[model samples]
Each structure stands twice: as structure tokens, then as C-alpha cells.
Target: MNAEIIGVGSELLLGQIANTNAQYLSKQLAEIGINVYYHTVVGDNATRLKETIHTAQKRADLIIFTGGLGPTKDDLTKETISAVLDKPLVTDEEALQSIESYFKKVNRVMTPNNKKQALVMSGSTILHNNYGMAPGMAIKVSGIEYLLFPGPPKELYPMFENYAKDYLLSKLEIKERIESRVLRFFGIGESQLETEIEDLLEKQSNPTIAPLAGDGEVTLRLTAKHADSKQAKKLIDDVETEILQKVGPYFYGYNQTSLPEELMKHLINEEKTIASAESLTGGLFSERLTSISGAGAVLKGSIVCYHNDVKQHTLGVLNETLNNHGAISVQCAKEMAEQIRIKCCSDIGISFTGVAGPKVQEGKEVGTVFVGIAIEGKETVVHHLQLSGSRQAIRQRSVYYGCHYLLKQLKERD
Candidate 1:
């Protein structure tokens, strides 16, 4: 069934807090084979909330409301919904008793307004809150289902898991499972990736392909629906295989995995140690690697040689090469990579050197980057790139490219 999530709070509109409830509910609904079509956020005003409910009723079979269930007068989620649905609010005896017990245990006097927390829509199934006082409720009006949940995550999460989930499952006539997988790619643009798999996207049926680009990386989320979970996964896998055939070289890891995480996994599996020499990127490459746990097992050290003098003295870059070709050249990158490997006694060494700034360096344009990869007993390779973006973007992309190249080399050995 199609669903719409409505968040009720002025804090969300004012940016005082994020609407994380919508995100969490969307994922949960998707897992149960419900498609979330839209997310609506409205303030505490009852008139606006009533208008939002009207809009949601037109397009969505299921409408879920979060927040505004509290003791204050502003807590009007149930009142607004009851008015919209022409339903009366009645007190849930169990919920009222639970709230009274909580206040007594805490040695606090219960106010008259606190009883409002026990109110539920007439003929609605009450969802007991184990973590907090306000209870949740679900009811159907004119063939559309309406669910009310508390705003706080601590209360909402358990109520949904323990009560709401099973309630929805019992109401479902057809049980279909939705499965999704995310494929991550670097060193490739979204337009190019889409072009390569244009036919698959056009003819998609069981498994739908959606591409998203962010931070110099592209990801495709493939989703499939089936009665059997394994069959749904198989449908996604078949589509993924077809897409990967065209862009396998640039494809890295899967959902929520970063380049550093994948690289660390490879290094740990291969029992290899690595070091880095940073020029334009500072210590970004090493910093990313060290952010992951067990980084000490695979990372030896790093040398930051932002200055020509440091390159010459610390990384042992030849003075003649720096004078003739400059620090941004291929010769300097190769020397930096090789020197760091020797100094750190690591199995692999990577170097990043470039001109990433508002102005050019050594007559080279901004975003002129060179990444060097030196593996033990292998020839050091340097990749020259002319990128475009802000100085920070250039530095970040340079580090990403360094990891990509290193991963490629490691895979080749395998």
C-alpha cells in the first residue's frame, strides 16, 4: 500500500530538530512492502495539520502522524485527526493508569493536563508505549488507515516495533517483501553511468534502478519486491550484474561503505601495510584511513610534505627535479611515493600532490592533481588529473582517487 508520513512540530519547520521520524518510518514501511510516496512536515497549528491530512488522504492509502502527543495544549495530533475524521477522542483506561503509576514512582504529582496523554481516537487500536507515557493509536476511516505515534524516538521506536508492526501485518491482505541494495562507484560520473545502463533503466520492471550522486561519487539503489525474500534478492542481483558489466572497473563497495573502509578491508585481508605522502591534500588520506577501527594494523605512518624543502629533506625528493619540473609534476609524485614506502618499510605507499586553490601553482592550473601508487617489487604508477571544484573538493577528490588507484592495484595482484 502507498503511505504518507506527516511530521507535526514547529521545531522541524524552524530547523530546531530534523524530521528523523519520517526517515525511520519510511525505512520501516518499505521493509513491510509499503511504498512511502511523500513526507509532509507541518507546524503545531491544528488548521494546517487538518489541511495536510486532507491532502494525504487523497493520495495515500495509509497516513502516519508523528509527534504532538503530549500533556500540553499544543499537543493536538489526535485532536486534529479526530476532527478531520469526525471521530471522538476517548480516554484509554490502561494508558491513564500507566501514566499515574509513572508519576507516583517518580514521586511527582500528576497534573490534570497529563490525562490528555491517555486519549485515543474512538474505535482505534491503542499502541502501548513502554519507554514513555504517551500511547500510540491506529484506526481506519473511509477505507484509509490513520496511525498516531509519539514524537520522541525512545517511545516511538519500541511502540512501533512491539505493537504497530504486528497490527499492520494483520491488516495486510497480500504479503509482499521489499528488498534493496546500493552499489557505490567512484572515478565515474552519474551521467556516464546512467548512459551505460540506459536500456536497463528504461525496461526496469521487478527491480527498479535509481541513481544518486554526491561528493564526487555515484550510487545506484536497486529495489525489488516479491513474496519470497530470496527471490526478491535474486531479482536485484540479476539487475546489479547487468549494470556492473558496463562499469565494473569503477564500482567499489556496497551500501554505507566508504572508500577508506573498503581499502582497509582489502589491506587487512591481504596482510599488507601502507603509508602515505601528502602534499596538496595535507594528511587527508591518512586521516581517513585512521578513522576506521583496526587502522593501526594496516597503516604504518604518513609524511606531510606541503613545502618543497620538506619534500627534499624529509621525503628525499631530488632538489634538481623540484627546480626543473616543480613539486606538482609526475617526477615529484613518484619520488614521494617511493620514498615514503622505503621510509615506513610498508608494502604499499601512496602520494597525493596537486594545485588545489583559488590560484595556480608552479604555472599549473587549479585542480591539477597527481596520484602515485608504489607497491613493493612493482613499478610506481602516477595518474594525472585535471579536476574542477573548490579547493577542498579538489583535495577530497584527490584522496578518493588515491584510494581508488591503490584498490585497483591490490585487486590486480589478487
Candidate 2:
């Protein structure tokens, strides 16, 4: 069914808050093969909301709304919709009891206006709110279905997932399941990756392939639909296998898993401890790694040796090497990695030294980078990269490359 999302909040228009509810609902609707044609945002004005509803009613069969379900006077989402549908708003007994129970649990007296949170359109199917006072509703008027949800993400996400999802499924005549998988890749430009997989993109039908690029990484989302879920998954797997055959070298992890997460998982699984000596990246590599839980077990420590003297004094990098090759060289990077590994007594040492700027440094151009990796009982290796971007982008991409390189090393060891 075609759907239109109407977001009701002055905060959204004023840029005080994002309309994330529409994004969430659109994704949910897509999984059920519903097309979201338009997203309309209106402030707490009844006349404008009425006009918006009239326009949506002529185009869409399903109209979903978020926000304006609170105790305040501006909470007029239900009132406006009631006026448009010519339906009466009545207090839901179960919802009223839920609201009262919430106030009793908190040992606070329930205010009179709070009862407005329990009101729903007459003859509507009530959606229970497990997270907040405002229960949602779904009703049919003149062959059009209207779904209402509370604005807060915490309240709206659970209510839609627990109640509204099942209700929508029950209304569907055809039973179909959509299975989606995201393949994450690094060390490849988006255009190059797309060129390599052009054949797959062109002929895809059962499982559709869509490529997206962001933050020095590329992701391809593959979706397949079928009556049986297992069959749908198999279709996706078949397409994924074909795509991977061409570009598996750059591919790293799956849906919702990132380069840092993959690196941490590798370290934990292999029982290896690591340390880092940072230069231009300025501890970003260590920060990203430590953001994951249980990082302390695999991360011995890190040193932000931004200066040549600090690298020599703290991480034990040879002063002669720094003097001869300068800070942004492969020799300096190699010594920094090997020395930091020895100082921290870690199984692995990784170092990042780069010239991320608008100006050249020590005869090297901007975006010149050297990443060094040293593993116990293995020969030290350094990867030289000439990247392009702003200073912040260069620093962030260096951290991503470190994780990608570490994962590649761990996989090769196996």
C-alpha cells in the first residue's frame, strides 16, 4: 500500500529536533513492500494540518502521523485528525488505566490534562504504549487507514515495533518477507567498486543491490523478497556470493558491524594485545578501538607522540631515524610502531604518521600518510598511503585504514 508520513511538531520545523520518526517508519514500511511517497511536516496548527490531510487523502491509502500526543495544549494531532475524518475522540479505558498506573508507580498525582493522552479515534484499534503515557491508535475512515504514534523515539519505536507492526501485517493480503544484508568494504573508492560490480547491478531482480559510500567506506545493501523467509535469504546469499567473488579482497564485515568492531573481535578471538603511537591522527585510532566494550583486555595502551622528541623519549623511537627521515616518513613510522610495542609489552604495535593539511611538510605533499604494523615474532610492515580530503577527513580515514589493515593482517594469520 502507498503511505504518506505526516510529522507534527513545531520543533521539527524550527530545527530544534530531527524528523527521525519518518525515517524509521519509512524503513519499516519498505520491509513490508509499502511505498512511502511523501513526508509532510506541520507545526501545531489545525488549519494547515487539515489541508495537509486533505492532500494526503487524495494520494495515499495509508497516512501515518507522529508527534502531538502529550498533555500540553499544543498536542492537537488527534484533534486535527478527528476533524478531518469526521470521527469522535473517546477515552480508551485500558489506556486511561495504564496512565493512572504510571503516575501511581511514580507516587505523583495525575493531572487532568494528562487524561488527554488516553484519547483515541472512535472504532480505532488501540496500540499500547509500554514506554510512555501516550498510547497510539489505528483507524479506518472512508477506506483510508490512519496510524498515529507518539513523538519521542523511545516511546514511538517500541509501540510501533510491538503493536503497530503486527497490526499492519494482519491487514496485508499477500504474505511476503524481505531479507536485507549489508556488506561493508574499505580500501576501495565507491566509483571503482561500482564499476567492478556493474554486471550484478544491471541484471539484479530477485535480490536488488544498492551501493552507498560514506566516511571512506562503501556499503552495498542487498534485499530479496519471497513467500518463504529461508528462500528469500538464499536468494540474497546467492547474489552476495557472486558480488563477493569480484571484490572480496576489500570486503570486511556484515550489517551493523564496523571496521573497529571487526578489529576488536579479531584481537579478542586471537588473544592478542595491542598498542599505538599516534602522530597526525592524535590518538583517534586508540579512541575508536577503546570505544568498544572489553577493549581493556586487548588494548595495552597508546601514546600520542605528536612531537619528535616525545616519540623518541616515550615510545623509544630512534632520534637518528626521526632526524634522517622526518616524522611523516616510513622509517619514522616503522620505528615508532616497533618501539611502542616493546614499551607497552603488547603483542602488536601500530603507528600512524601523516601530513594532513593544506601545506606540504618536510618535502612531502599533503595527504601523505604512513601506517606501520609490527607483530611479535613477525617482520614489521609499513603501508604508505597518499590520501585526499580535509584534515579531519584525513585523520578519520587514517583510523579506518588502521582497523582495516589490522583486520586484514589477522585474517592472513589464520
Off by over 4 Å in 1: 104-112
Q: How accurate is candidate 1 locally (lDDT)?
A: 0.94
Cα lDDT of all candidates, in order?
0.94, 0.92
Model 2 agreement with the true structure over 259-368: per-residue lDDT tens digits: 99999998999999999999989999999988999899999999999988898887888888888889999999999899999999999999999898989999999999
Q: What does candidate 1's lDDT look like per residue over 1-414, in tens digits?
A: 899999999999999999998999998889889989999999999999989999998999999999999999899999999988999999999999999999999999999999999999999999999999999999998999999999999889989999999999888898899999999999889999999999999999889999999899999999999989999999999999999899999999999999999999999999999999999999999999999998999999999999999999989999999999999999999999999999999999899999999998899999999999999999999999999999999999999988888898889889
> Clashing residue pairs, candidate 2?
none
Per-model TM-score versus the true fold: 0.94, 0.96
lDDT of 2 at 339: 91
